[model samples]
Structures are given as structure tokens and as C-alpha cells.
Target: MVCRVSGILLAVASAAAVGGCGGEGGPTSPPPPGPPPPPPGPTIGASLNLRPGEVHVLSERDAIRAFEIQGAAEGREYQVIVMSASLSEGRTTPLRVRARADDVSPNVVPNARTNRSGRDAAIPPARGLAGELRPDRDWHLRQMIETERELRRLRARPAEGIGRASRGLAAAVSDVPRVGDTLTVRSAIVPGGGVQCTANTPIKSTVRTVGEHFIIVEDDRLAGRFTEEDYADLDRELDEFIAPVSHEYFGEPDDLDGNQRVIAFFTGEVNRLSEPESGSVVIGFHWIGNLFERENCPASNEAEIVWLIGPDPDAEFGIEIGVDFVKRVARSLVAHEYQHLLNASQRLGGQRGQDTWGNADLWINEGLSHVAEEVTGFYRQGLRVRGNYGYTELIAGDPDLVAFRDFFEGNLENAREYLSATTEFNPLALNNNTLDFATRGWGYVFVRWFGDRYGPAGPGGIVAGSGEAALYRELAVGGPGYLFGYENFLRAAEVVAGETTTWGDVLAEHFAASAADDAHEALPDGAQFSTWNWPRLWEELRTAGVRGLTGGDPLRRRIIQMGAGVSSTDEFDLGSSTARYYHLRAAGGHPSMIVETTIASGGNVPNSAEARIIVVRTR
Candidate 1:
């Protein structure tokens, strides 16, 4: 029964399956499986995040996504591994990767799997990302971290390890940054106690304040700024200019070291006088342009004098006005002003006198100063007079010495006459007729005459010893005062000579002596005559001249003849006849005298002496 039932079931199941298949089609296949799903797309295997000085692992999703973009559908499989990564300040770090893949068909192998390593290696590390944190994605992260840490330590210990590194960096960049050719420094005086200077680099140093006290360094852009080398050169030149003059006038180098000494001396003198010191005197030893300018006087000393000196052309003394003459002139100027100071202090009588311009007796003051210049040798030798009063005017017209004198005396008869005079006296008038000769001519002549008459044992005997003080005393009280008061100095001199045998007699004797000496030198040895031995020869000649009416004897006639002889033969006469004869007679001695003349052979008076022989002995 079980077998019959199994057979019947099998037969029915088959019939049912056949009938169902026959209902659909003649050969029905099992329902086709739903279209095979598309092969799985590549997966993102990894991703990375980076930071400064650090490394990071990449996410698997990022890696899969990269593979997906790089791989195609055929056969995609990859194991991506980062080989290295690096980062730097101005550059991006490169990431290296390794990848491998295999598939049934080469065409089916996805390009992403085959080239995953190369594609990963090409990507740069994200900015701010460090290599250390991305070990899996970037193997080189460890190396970068080690290097960066070393750099950090080096920078931290800049004084130690950084020097070498910095030097290396500098050397590497030596071709880039270049140094400049010149550097400058700018300096200025600060109101208080010091000076401020600026240069290319910060510099703070104190300089020596001995010679040039206030000195400051200046920047290159500042005008008049100098460098060390320039300062050295300038200093050298300044030393030269000041050396000679300073040595001559101010003693030695150790005594007067700088301009301060000069200032102190002037100020001390002024203060001693108790006069109201008006203004400050600025002594600018370095300034060269103009020595003085009234308009630019400092407010502290409105009436002050500014003495400026320029660089020395010779480079001997680093001072201005080093020339000997210049220093002498300067000294004289100072002395002159000092004298005025003294007069003011003493309340001298002459100081109160006024001239035509309502000024004090400038002539006397200036004349005295002019004389002082000679005595002190402040000016060139022989510069006794102020010469050029009408020189400028003389250029246009012949100089009228008389007119010049009138102008100088300020004694013009008329305004027109005054106008016609040389302008030297009126320096303010720059007219065409103005001349400088008046100052030169009158100044010198008057001073010379004064010196000749009154100086050093002249008749009045006013010697120049302690400047004008002694001179003034002698002039005020000595023979000069009496003679000047009586208007008889010249007359007195003449009378003194006349009473002692006359100036003419003395001069004659001098000429005769000089002639005799010359003739003696030229003659044979035995021909010379001694005044004592030939007393009669000289005595006979004294009375042989034309007799005079006033004199008892013909001594006056002899004197006249002697005077004539001097005038005729002065050129050949070496010594002054008047001087020689006075000395001889004062010493109780006489000079041998002689006369010689050449007459034409045809002259009349045969057998007569051709030349008259005259001799005089007045012992």
C-alpha cells in the first residue's frame, strides 16, 4: 500500500509541475534572480588631519574615497599605506603611500587599487598639519617631528646652538640681503646737559669733551653730519690752524687747551672792570664763513662779538685763524678793548670828551690803539699808520693830500668842498670819488712822526713799555706836555742845537768826517789825518767862508759851508751827519774834515789850489 501511494504522489506532483510550466510557456525556467546588484563601489579606507609640528592618521573613509575616485569598476581592491609626510613654513609637505592589488582579469583590476600608493604620495599635507600625528598616513611624520623639536630647542637656546644655525642661514642668504656702502650719523645739541645723536644703528656713547666739547653722532641723511673718518680729518685740520697761533699768543699747548681759556680771559677782564657786560661773546673756532656778524649776535649778549674760524688749509692746527699775524691782530684788538675797559674803570678825563658825531674822542683812542699795534707787533712790520682813507677815490682822481687832510680833520669849509674831498674819512659814503688813501696815508705818517719825536728817549722821551699807560703818563707830564702847551717843541730842539754850535755845524762836521774816512780808505796808508794831529788845518777852514753879519767871528760862515756840504753829498753819506757830529762834540772830541774838487784843466787862476781846503776843530 505505501509503495502504491508513493508512486501515485510522485505521478501527481510531476503532472502538477508539468501543467504549471505548460501554463506559462513550453519550457519555463525558474524565475531569473533579480538582476545581479551592481558590483560594490570602492570604499573609503582612511583619512588624515594635520596640525603644526604634528602628524595624524588618515581615516579609512578618506582612503576608501581616494581609492574610489582613482579605481574603476572592473576589479577594485587596495591596501593603502602612507610612506611619508612632511611640512614646513613656506612649503607643503608631500604624502607618500604604498598600494597593491590583484584580480582575475587585468582589465577588471581597478586603477585605484593598482596606483593607490602613487596617488596618495602625490597629495600635499593639509596646511597647519604636522607630520608627527599622521604616522599611519605619513611615515615621515616622525622624522619631521624630530627635526622640528631640534629646531625649537635651537631657537629656545638662541645664545648657544642658534648662533651656528643663524650663521648658516645668513650664509645661505648672503646673496640676497646686501650691506650698504656708507653709513651716517646725525647729532644735535640738547637743551640741557648733553647731545643727542642718531645713526643707522642704535648707539649710545660719551665722547671726550676736552677740545670740541659738544659732539654728537649723526645719521647719514642729516646734512653736516660726519663719520669717524671725517671727524678725524676735520680734527686734524683744526689742530693745525690753532697750533701756531695758540703757541705764539697763549703760551704752550698745555696752558691754553681750548676756546674756553680765551673766553674766560676776556670775560674775567670785563668783569674786573665792573662795566656792564652787554652780550655774550661766541667764539666759534670751527665756523669758517664770516668771522663776525653784528646782526646775528646772540640775545644773551646783543653787543657781543663773534669770532669764527675756518678749517686750516695747512692741517697743522685744528684751529681757525692759526696764522701768526691773525693771532697778533686778535690780541691787539682784545688789548685795545681792555684799555677802554681800564679807562672806564678809572674814570679818565679824556673818556668824557665828545667828537662831531657825538662819539667820544675816537681819534685819540684809535690813534693810541694804532700805535699800540706797532709796539706789540700785531700787524705786519712797518704798519704804524692807518693808510687808506682816500685810496678808493684816488682810483678816479689824483689824490689831493690837502683835501684828504681836511676831510680827516672833519674841517670842510663848505658842504660842497666836503663832498669833493676823498671819501676815506667818510667811509659810509661809497661815492665814486671816495678814496681809501686817507686812512693809509694819514694813519702811518702821524704815528711815525709821533714815534720819531716822543718815543724811547726822543726829546719828550715817551717810551712804549707797558702799552699806552706809560705812554700817556709821559705825554701828559714830560717835556712833551710843556713843549706842546707852548707850541715850542720844534723850536726848543732847534735852540738846543744852535746853542751847542748849531745843528748846521754838527751836520757839517759829520759829513766832513765821513768824507775823510772814505777818502782815507781809498788812499795810500800815510795820507790819512787825525783830528788832533791836523788841528790847525781844521781851525783855519772854520773862518774862511763868507763872513756873516750877526756873528763876531766867521764860525757861522763855516757852519753854513758844512751844511752845504751835507746837502750835496747825503747819498754817499752812510751815517746821519747831525747824529755823528752831536755825539763827537758831546764827548769833547772833533772829527777830521776835508774838501776835494776836480777842476777842468782850462780853468783860470794858474798855480792856484783847484779845491779849497777847510778844517774845523771845536773841542
Candidate 2:
């Protein structure tokens, strides 16, 4: 809100003579020795003019009085006068007088400073006393009240709109399948080099596209209902799934134990589902329900993939797969789910325990999984891709992100809301919350910093492996060790862009210099400062300036840093005080020698003490 103020006025009052008392016993014996010369009248000054309902304070020295102008309006001008009198007891009495619109003419007395003071002076308008004044109703105040009401109404509707939109979208897409269908086949290939299926068998599988490689499954069950469009959509999705991971390492072959365990695990499941040992997982493409619903399944030791039949896969995961070659849709689904399997295996060592599933490490798990989907060429919406990257980068960048990530991963504060029936296994929980915003933003910054500091090594010298643990370690160890270590990534970014000087250095110098002026002289010794303690001081350093200084003699200089300059002398007289001074110098500039004085009082004896030395960079 912006505020505008008009000019103010100050009015002074003149002394009035007291007439002699009439019919009062010959003037009460000559006014009791002249009544000590009939002490002087009070000097009157104008009250502070202000808008109606506006709070104002009148302060003379330390004594203050607060009042609101009840009759004035915003953008309107009025005159107010203050009359003050001092009593023999050294106390002051005050009175306020005001003039509203049309109460005084604009051309009144042609800017006369005062009316004639003699007995023959013209009589001025009968200005009412303070007791007679009344507050006027201001139209501007009414307008402001109405404006606030309208704004509140306007703000309320958008919130409702957002809630409605969320509900509508959820309702519309709630039934779409979270996982693609899985199919079991009795043979490796048909006479036409396509998948052949046998009855009463099922294999766990998911759909994915990997480059140009295509897998096709054709079964008699799907012959009448499947259309050409369905096949094409499946192929397209397959292509999208394989794009990002085609050249990227989902995990090192060594680390994944040559992928044998992963392949063996899936193959064993396929063998059970298919008759006569087909030796392969055949995917059957279909829709089940929302991603969360699939994740909510209570079955322990159940196969990770399930098959369902439906008209559209695009309705889920926001991917579009044109219809055609229904067999490839099955293959794509297998590939996509396989990637997840591979990722999960690498992260969890191929463990199939229920505890290993949905570990709530969504920032890393989902972020990396989404990245896997992207790298594999899945044609998901750009927003989803960006969102994943944004979150990944955020985690990579800051220690605070780690804290927030841990909080969300643990489902601490908003755990119930996040794990509610309506939203289970939902990555959107993090994205929609304030915690995600801070983490992601900070993570991106940290990743950029890691790139700058380590160069091509790109965080832990491993490009594709999960870098979370390494990044967390680096932040924990490196941040407090150096200035702006938390913001090191941003500093590196600035330096790369030619901003010169790391943010750490700048902050340290500023804080070191500003410490003197704003130092807490009365604070307990050995008190520690944390992030929460420095905001105002930082603002002052940024907006104002900081001064650095050194105290003590040459043998041992006591570094005294100040944001504003500190007085040199420590001595203070009952009548006057002098500031203790220290030598000043700029950061990275020459050091100059100077002298400072110290004065001690109170005549108290000191005792033996012990001290712990701690070194901290101010920036």
C-alpha cells in the first residue's frame, strides 16, 4: 500500500491580559502582593495534522502522547493547533484545536502571521475550544473500507476456483491406469516374428520405448478389439521412454552386478506366468487406475507389474501414444516398467521386500525415476520433465534442501495429508508444498555450484549414479567451513558469468566491518550467532555499509569489526563520554596501523578464566 501526505501546519498562541476583578473586596488586597507578576501564558503550537483514523504521536524529548485525527480524511487538508502550558511544578498541560473544510477561508487575512494584539485589535472569528470539537465523517475512509471488502471477496474466489479445478481434474482422470498391462506368452515369436500368447498365464511387465528398437506381441484375445491406432500410440510411447536413457547409464554394470540379477528376477516371474518356459517377459498394454491407487496396493511380495486393458494410456502420465500395432504398446509398457525395476534394483540391490518399495525418498527416487523416463525418450509433458529436473537440481545445490528433503521423506509434518487415501505414492505432494519450492530452488543452485567447483566431474565424479549421498556430505562438511558455502553454487554461477568475487567473500567482508557499529555490547560473553540472528545486520550491511577496524597495540592486535564505526575510547565520564577508536581498513586493501584508548572503572578484581578460541569467516 502506498501513502501520500500533504503539508502540515504549526500554530502559535499569543498571551492575553487578565482584567482587574470587579466587586471583589477592593481587588482582594491588591491581588495578594501582585500575585507574583501573574505568570506568563502558555505558548500554543499547531497539532500534527493527519488523515482521519490515522495514528500519530506528539513527542517532546522522551515524553510522548499518542492520538488519532478523527475528523480528517486522506488526501484532504485541515489545520490543527496545540496549546501547551508549563506549571510551577515543572509539568506540561496540552490542548488540541482543529479546523475542517470551509471552517477557515483560503484567503483569510491574506497570510497574516497574527492579529493585532492591542485593545483596539479587530475581533477574530470565534474559534471553538477543544471541548466543543466533533469528529467529521470522512468519505475517503468509507471508500477504503469498501475497497478492502471488495478485495477480500476477489481473493476468496480464486482459491475456490483452484480447489474446484483440482477436484475436477482428479475426478476426470482418477480411473486411468497407473501401470501398463503385462501379458504372458508361451513362445518367443510367432511365424510372423511377433509375440505369441497362451492361455491362463500372466507376467509382470510395464511399457517403455528405447530408441528405434520395437517389441511386438500379437494374441488371438486382442485380435478383434485392438485397432491400428492403438499399436501406433504404443510405439510412440516406447520411443519417448527410451530417449533419455538410450545413451545414459541407469547404473554402472559393475554396480548393478552385470544386470544379471535384474534380468534373472524378471525372467523368473515371466516363467511362472507363462506356460512352457517362453524365457521372456511379454507385456500386455492396458490401464488400471491412477498412479497413487496402484501404489496403494496392500499386497506384499506381489509382482511389481500388473496388466489391465483400456482405451487410452495417454490419459495417465500425460503421454500421448497413437493407436497402431497394439503389440508394440505391450513392449513399450514392458520397457518403461523395466527401467523402474532396473532403477529400483540398483538403489535397493534387487530386494523385493515390501519395505523396499515406496521408501518415501521421492525427491531422489521419483526425481531420478522421472529423469530415467525422460532419458529413455518418454514423451511426457515438458512441465513434468522440467519439474523433475528442477527438483533434482534443487536437492543437488543446498544443505537446507537436504533437511527439507529429509522432512518430506520422513513424512513428518504433513505426512497424513500427503499419505491420505486421495493421494498415495504421489510425487505431487512435494511439488505442491512450500518445502518443495525451497528445496528445489536451493537444489538447483547447489548443483550449479557443484558443477563450478568440481568442473566436469559434476558432483561426486559420477554423472549417472545417485549423487544424493555425496552431495549431502559435501554440504555438511564444506558449508560452514567457508563463507557462503551454502550459497557456493550461486556464487560460482555469478563468477562464471563475470560477476567477480564470490558471494561468500563479499558477505564476510561486509559482516566483519559492520560488527562494530551494531555489536551487542550487553550480550552475554561466549554467545553464539546463528543464521536466525543475522538478517537485520545483513540488511544494514547491504543497504548501508560496514567498517572494519583493528584495536590494541602492535604486539597483539585485537580485530574489531563493525558495520558502522565504533568510538575509539572506552572511557565515559559522568558528564561526558568518548568513543573508543580503532584503525579502519577495507577488505583486500592495505593494513594501516592506528591507536585506540581504553579506560576501566568500577574497581572490581578479576579472577582466573578459561576461554575457547573459535575462528569463523564473516562472509
TM-score of each: 0.21, 0.24
Candidate 1 residue 239 C-alpha distance from true site, Å: 22
| Deviating ranges (above 4 Å) for candidate 1 | 1-329, 332-363, 378-437, 454-619
Provide the lDDT at 449 for model 2.
25
Measured by TM-score, how close is model 2 to the native structure? 0.24
Cα deviation in Å at residue 316, candidate 1? 19
Tell me the tens digit of each residue's lDDT in model 2 across 188-307: 122221222111133333322112433333333333344556555655654444423422434321111111111111122121222222222222311111111111211111122223
lDDT of 1 by residue, 492-544 (tens): 33333222233232222222432232232332111222211122322332333
Q: Per-residue error at 514 for model 2, in Å? A: 30
Count of clashing residue pairs in every prediction = 80, 76
After superposing candidate 2, which stretches have Cα over 4 Å from the reference?
Answer: 1-220, 224-247, 252-339, 350-358, 376-619
